[model samples]
Target chain A: MSLFGRQSKRDLHSLAAPYALDALEPHERARFEKHLRTCDRCTAEVRALSEDAVRLAWSTAAPAPLAMRDRVLAAVRNTPQEASPLGAAPPRPHHLPAHVWGTEPPPPRRRAPRMRPLFAPLATATAAAALVVASLFAVQATRTQDQLDTARAQSREIANILAAPDARATNERDARGRGIGVIASAKEGRAIVTLSGLGDLPSGRVHQLWLMRPDVQPRSLGLFQGDTPLVTSGMNDDATSLAVTVEPNGGSAQPTSQPIAQLALKSVGFGE
Target chain B: MEADELLVRVAGGDQKAFEELYGLVSGPVFGLVRRVVRDPAQSEEVAQEVLLELWRSAGRFDPGRGSALSWILTLAHRRAVDRVRSARAATEREQREGMRAHHPAFDQVAEEVEAGLEREWVRHCLERLTSLQRQSVTLAYYDGYTYREVAEQLSLPLGTVKTRMRDGLTRLRECLGGVA
Candidate 1:
């Protein structure tokens, strides 16, 4: 009855049981994984189980309401960009004031502290202090220049995206078109949907998307906001209908009533 | 352009690209948080925080590690878990316990009523497990319950609960064909 020993089927199952739930003690799981490489049967079992767990996880994943999407995207828009950890350092700006720029200069290539006769000690210390000030300015200027260049390049890239042809398409949401806009797109897998011109919802309300197909009832694609777009799954041409509605802030089991605006999508297009 | 490409533009400081990337990742990011956090209001709050974090940190994303989707999901998961854990710590157990009392076990439900792209794969894989194994696995992963907690809830021995969870995951991995 004890399947705690060796490579027998029962023992393997017993060991794999915890691995399935991710409940294994770390050492035990590691040992089982080691044995799994050589044992095809165990490997197969583990794979099957993990997939089941993924399904369970998937079932529970409901789309977050539209307001949340707007909030997050809006946040992303405002968030500052950080320098690449791997990219080359930005060139130092030559014109910036030394005080405003880079790291302080190395302390006048400090000479080792020397014991001097007491009388001239003040003079020696003053000289050393003066030297440090001069070096600090030089180092500060160089670092400041580097930071300036990085900021300048980043700003230019941003300028280009704004100037791009599609920039207007995304930024200005159309009211006449029933608040329709394409936020972002991929050829095969997904796209971001945007809307505007729709009146704002009350505090607890959020917009939602439904992917309508002939074969099934409209599926709750996810939530969105009039101010920002949403990324919904299953956007192919087969996805005949796209509709929006106000649901409870996080969205609902289904569209409670008619959509605020319903648009038919012929095909899922790649982002322009 | 790809959504990730737009995100790269956003990182460069393009407002349009930032807007575009927002459209693409926002749903999953939001949905993921909502699933974990449960409260619509709180979920939205967490979602807003995650998005802002994503925008601020877009420059940090490296395509090498994984897709943009994964990057966003990782952020959402971390934030949601953080929110839940923090709230759990701040509130009494009884209050939080009342909040989670009515949730249904995913396995007991038939198939996902909505046939999304991944639904079939998800259903097939989940169906492969024995009922007990499936239940234990779902409670731990999706519900965010620990194995010991699951054991207590189901009135099963701790070791037995652990075994079922492991076996359940193993079966799922195989059924899904492989991990991403």
Candidate 2:
């Protein structure tokens, strides 16, 4: 049975309204967020709304002062941009690979701004503010680094799955055109598929994914919509291959619509 | 410079960064608060407080989650809302009309306005909303009032206000060509 309530669905539109404005009550906010995990339609809708709201800042803008710019520049001179990878001394030139060429260290420089004693308080505020900013930078730098690491890990996993010894490739098509897909072991099986622009879905509908082999009918992994990134579960040893289809909200038990994305593995070492 | 970059510089104890950031965002921040709070002097004070808070809390900003502009506006919006709501029951709200706050910080926002990237998409979307829809969204968002408060302020039926807000935002999302 569907987990959603009728009032919930009716409230869906209203719920989205505050979310669009970022005015949702805490409880209502949590409820909508949980709903967002499954409701891609609402997710897409909310994003559009947020962007719309952001534009308001433009309509009501006033120019900042010239002195403020000078203040920012002067204050900026006090902070470290980033810790130098190489300390103090300049690096001796070396004949190395392309990646190493630009990594050399330069001369040490202290570019602190010259100031009046009376402006010490301002300088202190500047220093304190810079420290706050540095800490913020560190936090953001870590997050960016983490995101890069995650992307690299996911890429490596996909590469390993596709390059396995038992890998097989197949070409299949539904209403959409044919494309190549590879599956290694159904146990180790993973596929990476890409499609250009697809037609838009209606308000309540979503595109669902399916896995199919020769023996059993197509089984669903979950629902996906538009061009969002989707990762499927690791196939069981018994399962053979995969196919994809666009279906309504919760997806269907069987193939109710034509597949938009499909793939079959090449015979490398084993089929059993 | 971008808001994120300014925020980063500010976080590193750059008073110039704070000043720049204050200059850059203060107008919208102050204007937004002014629109909601409706007191020039109080709005400027709030803007200064907001800038100081930004300086203190610069470390908490996550650029990946939202834009620098959005982050500052969110802070401004929250403070404005809090200020008005708390002051709602007090007689001081009436006395605020004549007192105008003159902020040196406003020069920064005004300077940026000359070379700012206007979000035309939002402008167009907002224009499409009905007058009532626009009023409700502005009051609720800029002021931080509850839906009940919004209804009371407009003297409209609560259900009608809710529906208008919902429909208005929905159309806005559509007009803007999608959500975030």
TM-score of each: 0.42, 0.42
lDDT of 1 by residue, B10-76 (tens): 6776766767777676666666566666667566656655665555456666765445654566556
Off by over 4 Å in 2: A1-13, A19-47, A63-272, B91-127, B152-160, B173-180
The residue-by-residue lDDT of candidate 2 on B75-135, one tens digit each, is 6665666565555534344456635433211111122224433445455576788977876
Q: Model 2, A40-80: lDDT tens per residue? A: 78766666566555555545555433333332332233223
**Candidate 1 regions off by >4 Å?**
A1-63, A82-272, B1-15, B59-62, B89-91, B94-117, B156-163, B178-180
Docking class of 1: incorrect
Q: For each candidate, report its DockQ versus the true two-chain complex.
A: 0.19, 0.12
Q: Residue A256, candidate 1: how far off, in angstroms?
A: 50
- Chain A fold similarity by TM-score, each prediction: 0.34, 0.35
